[model samples]
Target: MAQERRRRPARGHRRAAAPRPPEPGPVLELEVERIAHGGVAVARHEGRVVFVADAIPGERVAAQVVDAGRERFWRAETVSVLRASPDRREHAWPEASVDRAPEQRAGGAEFGHIAMTRQRELKAEVLRDALHRMGGVETGAAVEPVDPSLAPGVDPEAGTGWRTRVRLHVAPDGTVGPYAARSHTVVPVASLPLAVAGIQAVAPLTRKLEGAAAVDLVAPAEGAAQLIVRSAGDRRSSRGEPPTIIERVGVRRFTVDRDGFWQVHVGAAATLTSAVQDLVDPDRFDPAADNQDLYGGVGLLAAAVGDRFGANVRITTVEADARATEHAGANLADWVGARAVTARVDRYLDELVAAPDAATRGLTGATVVLDPPRSGAGRAVVDRIAALRPAQVVYVACDPVALARDVGLFRAHGYELEALRAFDLFPDTHHVEAVARLAAIV
Candidate 1:
């Protein structure tokens, strides 16, 4: 064989070139313009929107792009403050920064680095922005700070020690702590500065919970503190007795499941109840005008209305959860004309809308006050409520975006957003509660 050329290795047998590692992202200096939703600060990098966590508006900071691959905008965290704002303060919870990564920081207290007053200012900016961008109605509705006088035992200067409810994660070693932002990593918490004294007192119970997945500490306004140990196998059952606690809204007392949804802020109930009553002004409406409370948890708003307008106001409260309805019925039992109906809000609205006119159905001039969940009462509910030509609709909302979207829906149905009041119920975090009053356009 003539010089048999050495056969090259078959293509299939050839070694593959090492896969290239992902390119390192860019780091740049950003001048934060304003605080955005989700506890982030708005900044621009080469004309691209960059949301920087742990940064305050009016500050220049060095940031690294954490999600550059995203198309519309980029996400970043402040690497260092190049120009600190007056609002910037030492983090209230230093231990929360156990990990260098912002997403790995302990949960809650996101605004610990900002002063309490400045935190409220930033939250107001966020609310205004949401209303303008989403609701398309930019009136001078402002976010108001809670006066310490409204809530007893609350310190005006101190933003900590207000949380009456806390959920802690359990680590493999039986230690309980908070989960890192957007992560399952648990950061051991020896102390919770944001929790009430009663919740803080039960910190030692974590070690006793071996097989528990997490623990919920609930300290209601009236009643002994209750600890609920959640297991990994079954989330429904608790290690101890079902924690039922009593909360007061004005003079009305409500018995609520400890694990259920209640305002995290200790003084939230009192403030919200007062705001709702002020806006709804049930006393102004006709006593026979039917009033409905959607998502009425333990009938707080119903109770408040009943207190103002008396039992002859013809109030009907709707709640989906069986347990909550049971508690609501019990709570409203003393009110003669106040009744609790168990039904999903959407389904109930569907029936109410399809039912004969107010005169025929005996539900005339209905005034609705709803405390819907974060997702908010959708357009269907708004349209049906509007169709009923209700004189007043009071909405209690937790998420600004949801409120803005629903505000749009209300406008589409010829309902005007007459008044909106924002509250800093959740301090040191992104959450804020808002009460909006809508009136049908005559």
Candidate 2:
């Protein structure tokens, strides 16, 4: 009986134990060195570059890699701050906090965690880096905040409530909020701190609209506030009717479309208008000076130039969007020699380059001002402007990288970057406005 029991037990002996799967790698601990463009902090870990969102400079952070599988660089968000910077503050917007999940981070202000002064410093550094790295141009001065006098009408202390325009995504269930950063997922917002008084007023009411795909709120300095609701199937409506707003630049009035291109910041329009007028110095040029405003949205710059030149300078505004061009014409109707031309900037420049009569084409010793989109004026337009031998070219740029690229193009055509004035028109974000003065190297 003992032998039989032993044999039976030995036969049933052991099943092999399962091998355990490999354990996941650890979350990295990194010292953030500085803030980079696009509202991220730069750090290095074990010789690999890391970009940490929602972290400030001089902070030690535990970051979980969100992207970068076997890549040279990694994208991460701060999981925990081992050591925090003095510049770090509790985020202004509750949705921008690090404790919030990644999907909830899509639509809040990027610099909500940074101090106001430090935010400007970081933006200045970004502007400097873009100029030096992309355009090979060394700035004599860093990006500067706009002078308070430039926007006297606006309360300088009301920086957070300066956003005159805001767009929010509408969820399927009619919840309205900002789309999470780089995601289509809606992050329901009970309050938007960055919005102006008018937008904040309408944000709550948006939930009442059915089948809404998106909602836009605009509050102009000189007009009634309006809301635009775009529903599914492209149907659009406002509270009452399609709304238009008037923007006042000096004594000039511009009727901008409710859905069209306009500066989002409340102080931006006035600051930009004053900067353009100062840089162009229309008074310094001859009365018959040929001036062009390319990518002129609603003729803001054109009107400014015309006002300074007193309707004597032949000013032509080129706009690509039909809606914007129509508004531009209306805005510039009061100026005698100012006209809006609806054409792509490149095509308009090409026509100027190929015109048979240079004198008749208004290309000789002319001065040009271009407030191009974020993509910039491009090399072809720069070349054409050079061929025309303009005395000066004033460039208003929203994207530093694009401005740097076009600056390099201008340099290739023997144009020198005379002056660059970078303004903190867009605070609490990575965006800055730059007015670049390029003079022909005569």
Candidate 3:
């Protein structure tokens, strides 16, 4: 009978159970086997992988599990070193030393405890491994130091005081300092050894820094240091227009917003410019072709191309930031054929893909230089760039794994790696910059 039909439970009617909290665990004795990407050492416990921080490969350390919720892996930090690697040293930044409690150590100097030479060697190993495993391309590229001549009066070997940009955080209670390693908790510190002298002179580390949520210290190569304080709810905006600053790479000067993006190391700009110049052969540069720089910041790499070719060289710098595009227009004003367009790179390439035959022909023999962010140019962007069929592509990448993946995608599109060079731009850290030249298989 119809009256006998009972009401049934609706979909999602029952409340789901909450996830169980990760168990707090006893400290473990672990032997680190090798270094992995992102400033962590690989160790295994109970047949599961554990990423341990503050420990070097070939060392035994007692660590505390910070996270164990994941079924495949756990995260830990070294509490005490039972057996240290020969390459280990007193950390360059004492405040970030492993001797400190896990939650108290400063971030941004994850590799500070290792010797500089060994640090570069480890970076090289990481790069080569990524290229081989992910990109299927074998590389012997070593992470080299920025040339001493580029940064005169600075000690390159010391690997300290090279950073021209530094950011500090302010807690809700108004205490200001660098955030703790792997956390947003601000840890007050006495000194910032990685910052250049100019930044150190104006650092507001000891002050209360009231009414501000963050501070940006910028010390351009040719000018006095500038401190920008950002309020709690302001995001990146200010009262009026953000102030602009002048940055010098060799004799040429660039106008960059104080809040704009720039290479942090003093010599990074020059080193990259030189590397790009060396990678692009002058004879291959077609002045009539539509050369382009993707994610171009203030026309730095485009200027590198102009420096290698003539001022009459045809090139366009595409950037998402309007302010950076404005600066790029001014910076590249000397080049008659150079223009800066404000657009997302993928959209810009999409426009190129749909262009008329005459316009598309300009891209066929062109050279494309892309310095993508840490995420690197993903699969979609790589596919778009490949469709353009540029004669040559210069890829400047900061993350090894991302670069390797994109390189693999390019390989599938009949593009071959011609050359690759890595630079130790961010010393005492797991970060490395790589420049690769790829040519179409004709």
TM-score of each: 0.89, 0.88, 0.93
Error of 3 at 192 (Å): 0.3
- Tens digits of lDDT, candidate 3, 186-247: 89999989888999999988889766777878898667998877675554544688678898
Highest lDDT: give the candidate number.
3
Q: Model 1 reaches what TM-score against the true structure?
A: 0.89
Q: Tally clashing residue pairs in candidate 1.
A: 0
By lDDT, the better pick of 2 and 3 is 3
Q: 207 in model 1: Cα distance from truth in Å?
A: 3.3
Tell me the whole-model lDDT of each prediction, alpha carbons only: 0.74, 0.73, 0.85
Per-residue lDDT of model 2, residues 1-442, tens digit only: 0001111111111222324423334578999998787878999988998988888899999987777666787788777889989988777667767778766775658887777788878887887788888888998645566576645444343347678878777777877788776457778877777777777876754365557777768788785667766655453323464356787765667887665667777767778877887887443455466678888878888887777667665788887766677888888887777788888788888887777875455466667888876777778888888877777888988878888888988888888888888787866777778898888776
Please write out the lDDT profile of model 1 over residues 1-442, one tens digit for every residue.
0000111111121212334433446778999998877888889978989988888889998887777877779887677888989877777667554225654577787787888888887777888888888888886766676767656655545577788878787766777788766457667756788888888887653374567677768888897767766666554434465457788765678887765666778888788888887888453466677788888877878887777677777788887766677788899987788888888888888787777664365345667888887777778877778767777888988888888989988988888888888898877887888999888777
| 2 or 3, greater by TM-score | 3
Candidate 1: stretches off by over 4 Å? 1-24, 97-104, 205-210, 238-241, 281-284, 358-363
With candidate 1 superimposed using the best TM-score fit, by how many Å does residue 84's alpha carbon deviate from the native? Answer: 0.7
